[model samples]
Structure formats: structure tokens, C-alpha cells
Target chain A: MNNEKVWTAGLVVIGDEILSGRTADKNIAQIASWLQVQGIRLAEVRVVADDMDAIAGAVNALRTAYDYLFTTGGIGPTHDDITVDAIAAALGVDVVIHPQARAMLEDYYKDKPGGLNDARLRMARVPDGADLIPNAMSGAPGIRHGNIFLMAGVPAITAQMLHGLTGQLEGGAPLMVETVGCWTAESEVAEILREVEKAHEGCQIGSYPFFREGRTGANFVIRSTSRDVLESAVDTLCEALAETGRDFTPGGI
Target chain B: MNNEKVWTAGLVVIGDEILSGRTADKNIAQIASWLQVQGIRLAEVRVVADDMDAIAGAVNALRTAYDYLFTTGGIGPTHDDITVDAIAAALGVDVVIHPQARAMLEDYYKDKPGGLNDARLRMARVPDGADLIPNAMSGAPGIRHGNIFLMAGVPAITAQMLHGLTGQLEGGAPLMVETVGCWTAESEVAEILREVEKAHEGCQIGSYPFFREGRTGANFVIRSTSRDVLESAVDTLCEALAETGRDFTPGGI
Candidate 1:
């Protein structure tokens, strides 16, 4: 394996609705997938409430822990949308309305009803020294303060913001993955999986077991920064499974 | 509002697949909803990979931070399933095969082909002095080590385990909720939501906005420990929406 730098990012999903189970969070997976393609590993995720302290605490903790910190939710114009304010507090900065964002919102709402009222104009507010992450889906742009990104809670808007951010950040070698599925109990091959993972350098395997159709089975995912190592590990695991008289699928179940 | 002791819980989701974006997490919502019914608030959630240190760190942090701590994933029979070991390390305890869990698994797998093999028996392992939380859906029971719980990752299995645990925990008065939906932009009523929540001493209001069918709308949820306060807050919000000449739905849109 090459001694390449690994970039890591931390995500903080800010929403009380998520904690209340009123909203099943889509941002975690969306951001994780997006970061993976950017060659950045999503090292950790924290789901916090809409409260200002909670949001600020998570942002501060994650921003210092990872190369990048992405916060989703609470960027809206409502009272509960306190992410920008919280993040500002975390950065020891003052919140101010950005001229560019204000102009964008004015243009977007000029022909529409309600026409940029106080609540709608609240979207223009950002941290004092922050820049904007373009939002293709809506007029409200995302805030980019230092390495921290403040995004929309709406999945569609978050997607647009991420799309606009693609290829903008620096990344390292992307992790490659291979999956092998077997129609047998994972316990039946615990020793083999452990030994194979131990033998492989820079490669880790994860076993996900499932019970379906009155039968037990598992899918093993092999991941590594090097494709050759990942493939070699997968081959060894496949051989071991075959030797045990277990039928295995290459691409998983 | 009556002064009652509030119970809070934290969840640590341990899985590489979740962080890899290969799996969309259902356990967070499931556990959150279950905890709500049990009157325990899900205070925070952390999603970490399958690494032992990550799991142990999250477990130790959350277990100490909240009244109760629950973990999902990495508790199966595979080598990668190290939640039991991780939690044991976090609690400074030795790993032991619980005799009761072993007997239960033996009885459960007697008619199955595997028939309680060494790998399958691994499911019986728990931290020394830990008790079993019954699993009605599968053979492997959940682990209850003091105030910490280790549950399965699969949503179906987690649901069954939670069902087995319902009404078993001590909690405060359940937070009552009332939702008001309006086919108007949330920003348009931001002040109203803030003022209503502030006027109600014991209540909190969350505004969730959406854009659908070429129209912007929002759902406002009012939550409080006292039913009277919750109802009063909802009434005030509804009246404000009416005074603004906006049509609102009582339940949600």
C-alpha cells in the first residue's frame, strides 16, 4: 500500500425532527456518498437537536476533529433554523446579511408572491467572513465558513449544494470496495474472515449478516485505499468460502 | 408544568456500511420513536465505523453523558461483530459467555442446521455481569449491561428487541405534541412561531418547510411536557396563522 494522505470529514446532522423520529434523515447517507466520491472518508456523524447550543457544540467538536465539517439542516428561514447563528457562535464571529445572498433572494422573489419579507430575507444572513456555496435548486445559497459548510435541511436543496461543491475540495486516494455474498451463516466463517483480514495489509473487511427465506446469509465488504489489495483480499475470501463448500456471489446478494 | 425527572438516552450506531453510504440507517428513527413511546428522550446519536476504538469511545462517552445508552450493530456472530467486546472494554469488564444466553441459543438453534456451533455461540458472549434483553424475533438476545443496551442493527430485529423493552424503563411525563400545517412558506410565519413558543413557557415549536406542487408550505410542531401547555401553544399558533389569513391544517399536510 502506498503511504498516501487520507482526508476525512465529519458530518453533523442538525434537526429535532430527526431526533423525534418525525423525519428519517437522508442527509447522512447523501453526504457520506458525496464525500466518498470526493476521496474523503466520512469519519464520524453526530445527529443533534435544533437547539442553538446543541448545534454549536457539535459544529465546534467536529470542525476541529476532521479536515472538513459538514452540517445539514437548520439553514432555513424559520425560528428553528438557527444553524448559521450557531455556527457563527462556534467560530466566534458575528452574523450578518450577505449582500450577494440578499440580491439573489430579491431577484428570485421579485416576481413571486410574499416578495422577500423579513422571514424570507432571513436566508440572506451568514457569518461575517463566510462565502456562499451556490444553490442550484433554490435562491438561498449555502454558507461556507472556513472548512465548515452549512447546508439546507431539505434533501433536494442539500443535493444541489453538494453538486455545486463537487471537485472544489482537496482529497486523497479514494477507498475501493469489493463485496462477496454467501448463502451461509456469518458465524460459520468467522475464523476465515478474521484470518484473511489479518493477513491483508491496509485492507479491512466488514461482515453484514441477514436472515431471509428461512435461511441465514452474510455479505462481506472489503475496503482498501489500494484496488489491488482490495481485490486480493476478496479473492482470498472467495477461495476460503468456496473451500468450505459455501456458494458465494461475487457482487453480493 | 409539573417538575418531573426527565429520562434521556444516547445512541451509538456502529457500522462501516452506514458510514460508507451502502446502507441507509433505519435504527436511529426506530430507536428514537421507541424511546419516545417509553418517555425517554433520545438526546444524541453518533454513527461510527466498525473499529473497536471508535465503538468503545462512543459507548463510553454516551453512557456517561446520558441516563441510558443504546447501541446498534456489530453484535452478531461474525468476527467483525465486536460490539460486545467493545462495550466490555469500555466498561472495564471481561467478556464471558452468559450461561442463560447460551442455553437460550441452544434451544433456539436445536432444529436448525447450524445447531449452536462455536460461531453461533459467540452471540451468547456478553460483558461479565450483563443481563439479556429478550429478542422475540431472533435467537440471539440483546444485551443489557447496566444502563447500556446492545441491540441488533437490522431494523426488524431492533424493532422486536425494542418491543421486548417497552415500558421497562423509568421515565418522566411524556412530551405531548401538536402539529399545524400551512400551505405557505415557513419564513412567512417565522416571527409567529418564535413568538408563540416564547409566550408558552414550557413549550418548543419546530417549523419544517417543504416545496411541493409548485407551492411552498410548512408544518409547525409544538412539544411540551404538559398537555395543557402543548394544547395552548398549538391554539396560539393556529390563531396566529388564521390572523395572517393563511389556511392551516390541524394535523399536518
Candidate 2:
């Protein structure tokens, strides 16, 4: 099954705006997709408020539980930006202004108004003994402490930080996925799905049901580390659906 | 500060699709917004996979930490729809087919093609001694085991379940919000934000920065339980912004 070598990561989304429903979170999906491309499974996610205690607690728990931990939000240049401080507290380290980050901020803002003031300088702070993750989209760079990555809350900036980190992480085999769509209700083929999945040793199937255009249907997504196993599972599932006289589509509806 | 009566709820988003980044989660925003209207703060969130142990662990942890715990996903009519069973395991209760749920399913599916088959009947299973949260969008009712609610993963179905349970939960004072947008960089007014927030009792200010139209701006959201306090804080922030000679907008940019 090759489950022994699977790499997992956990994400901590730090913000009150998300928990308050004021901002719809885009980082979860963005980071999850990014982790998949890295062959790292995103095992869990915790969205906490801006409170120092909350952020520290989540960071401590997630960082220990997974191979990698990623956090987004509360890294801006305002009073509410406390992610660096909270993460430092979690790691039991001192918060220090990185020389490279300070240099970058200085060069970027020297021509702008309010040139590298105290508030702007806050963006250069990082946990002690941490390296910088280049932010090509903004002047403030992302922070990386050991296996934990601290990123921006803004989706675009986070994307740039993630792009900077591409191919830098060690990962196991990437998961292969195959999809099959059935026009019939999933309940009618629940037993078939289970039996097909059981027959495949290394594959898992997820059924996502949807009601659209006055009809109900579902897409079965089969994922496995082995592409051959995933393909075999899909073939069995399609054969079972055909045996049940249910009309099915190959990819999805 | 009216903190004594503040109500809280935790959400456990149960879906592999969400963790896999195949589907962007809508339940967190929907449930968070709904809880806010009910005057209950959405305190924390955990997005877990479809595995039984993962779901049960999150359910137990969240249900104990907050006044209410809501789970979305894995409550459909398929083999992967194992939320009812997982909740039962978490609660140390036996999984039983509720008579009322079964009757509802029969009535709903009588005119449909699959007339309440075994796979379809899986939706009627619930943790022992639990009640049902009506689902107007689908036949499968949401499960309510004490303060733990198991809802459908589909956004529309989850919304329907949430709608059915609205106004049924007890909560404290709803938070009131007032926002002021400033054309200046948030770093330039970081001191102002910190000072204004410190002056206002029971009020918090959050700065959200954005870059648009070749200019950097930020929206400051002031929140408090008391409307008078919120308005006063807004007035102080606006006055401070004016004092800085920065052009400001009333609502947001």
C-alpha cells in the first residue's frame, strides 16, 4: 500500500475575519492543492482567531502532529498582525528582525511614502533562527521556521510564497486520481462502490453527490499512490455500475 | 465587557474533498455567518478527513470545547457517508435506525425511482437518543446528538439544515460592527489603530490591507457587543484618521 512513506502536512489559518464569516477562506484550498502537487497530503486544518493563545496552541499541536505546518494571516503591518509573535511563542524562540528581510523592506520602501517606519519595520520580524520565504508579490517576505511556514493571508501573496517554495520540500509518491460519474443516485450504488473499493488494496473512493438541472447524480473520485491500482479500481467500479444498468460518465458530469 | 454571557460554537468540517482541495468549503462561511446571526461566536474550526477516527476525534474535541459543535459532510446515501456511525462511536452510543427518519425517507422516495432501498435507508441511521434537524432541500435529515450536529456536506443541503435549526439555539448579545476605510497604508496608521482599540473598552479593531488601482489601502473593522461603544470607537478612529490628514471612506473601499 506504500502508506509508510506518505508525507503529511497541517495548516493553521489564523484570523478573526474568517471565523467571523467576514472573509471566505481561500488559503485552505490553495495550500491543500499546493501540498498535493508536492506529494504531501494535507492531513488537517485548524482555523483559529487572532488571539495569541489560540494561535500558539494550534501551531504547537499541528506542528508536532504533521511533517509540515503552514500558517496564513496575521502577518501584515498592523496591530492585528501577531502571527510571527504567536508562532515564536509556540516554538519557544525569540522574535528577531531578519537582516535580509529588513534589507528588502528598506530597499522596497525607501522611495515610497512613510519610508520603512516602525509599522513597516514590523513586517521584517521573524522567529529566531528562521529563514525567509521570498514574496515576489510584496515587499514583506514570508517566514520559514524548521518545517513550519508562515505566509500572508492575502491569497495572491500566499501564492507567490508557495511558488517560491516549489520543489524545495521532500515528499513521497504523488497520489493518482480517477473519476467516474453516475446519473443514478449514489444510494442505489452504495454497495457497489464499497465492494469495488474493497477489491482494490491501495485505493480509496469518495462519492460527491450533487443535484443539478432537476436531476441527482454523483462523482466518485478514486485516489491511490499507485496509478495502476487506481485505474484498476475505476475499471471495476465502472463495470459494477454497468451491471446495475446505471448510466455512467467517465470523468464527471 | 459582557464576556460572561458570550456564546461559542465550533465547526468540524468533515470531507476528504475539502482536505484534498477538490472542493472549496462553503460550510465554514455559511455556518459562521449563521452562528453570528444567532448571537453565538464561531470560535474555532477543524477540517478533518472522511476517516472514522478523524471525524470522531474532532467531534469529541469540539463538542467539549464549545457550547455547540457542528459537522458538515459524510451524511449522504453512500458508503462514504459514515458520519452517523462515527458520531455514534464518539458518543459511545449504538447506531440505530430512527423510526421517524425511516418514515420520512419512505415518504420522500415513494415517488422516486429507488423506493427506499437498503442503501437509501442508510440516511435514517443516527446515534441513539438523538433528534433530527429537518433538511428542506433533501430527504436525509440532519442528526442532532445533544449539542453535536451532523449536517450534509453539500452547501445547499447544509444551508437548509441550518435554516431549520435557526432561532432554536440560545445565545448572548450579537456583536455589532462599524468599519472605516482609509486611503493611506495601514502601516502609516498602525499606531492609530492600536491606540484607538486600547481606548475603546470591549471593542476590537481589525485592519485588512489591500492593493488596488496602484494604491495601498486598508479597511478597519471595529467590533463590539454594545452599539454605542462600537459607534464611539468608529468616531474616534475616523477622527484619528482625519487628524493624520489621510482621506478616509465611511464603510469600506
Which one wins on TM-score? 2
Q: For residues A1-253, write the lDDT of model 2, one tens digit per residue.
A: 5646889999999999999898899999999999998999999999999999999999999999999999999998998999999999999999999999999999989998889999999999999999999998778999999999999999999999999999999998888788899887888889888998899997889999899899989999999989889889988998889887888999888
Chain A: TM-score in each model = 0.98, 0.98
lDDT score, candidate 1, position A30? 94
Q: In model 1, state the lDDT of residue B134.
A: 92
Residue range with the least summed lDDT across 10 consecutive positions in model 2 chain B: B1-10
C-alpha positional error of residue A187 in candidate 2 after TM-score superposition, expressed in Å: 1.3
**What Cα-based lDDT does every candidate model obtain?**
0.91, 0.92
Tens digits of lDDT, candidate 1, A1-253:
5788889999999998999988999989999989988999999999998888888888898899899999999888888888988888989999999999999999988987779999888899998999999997779999999999989999999999999999999999888888999998787788899999999998989888888898888899999988888888999999999998889999999
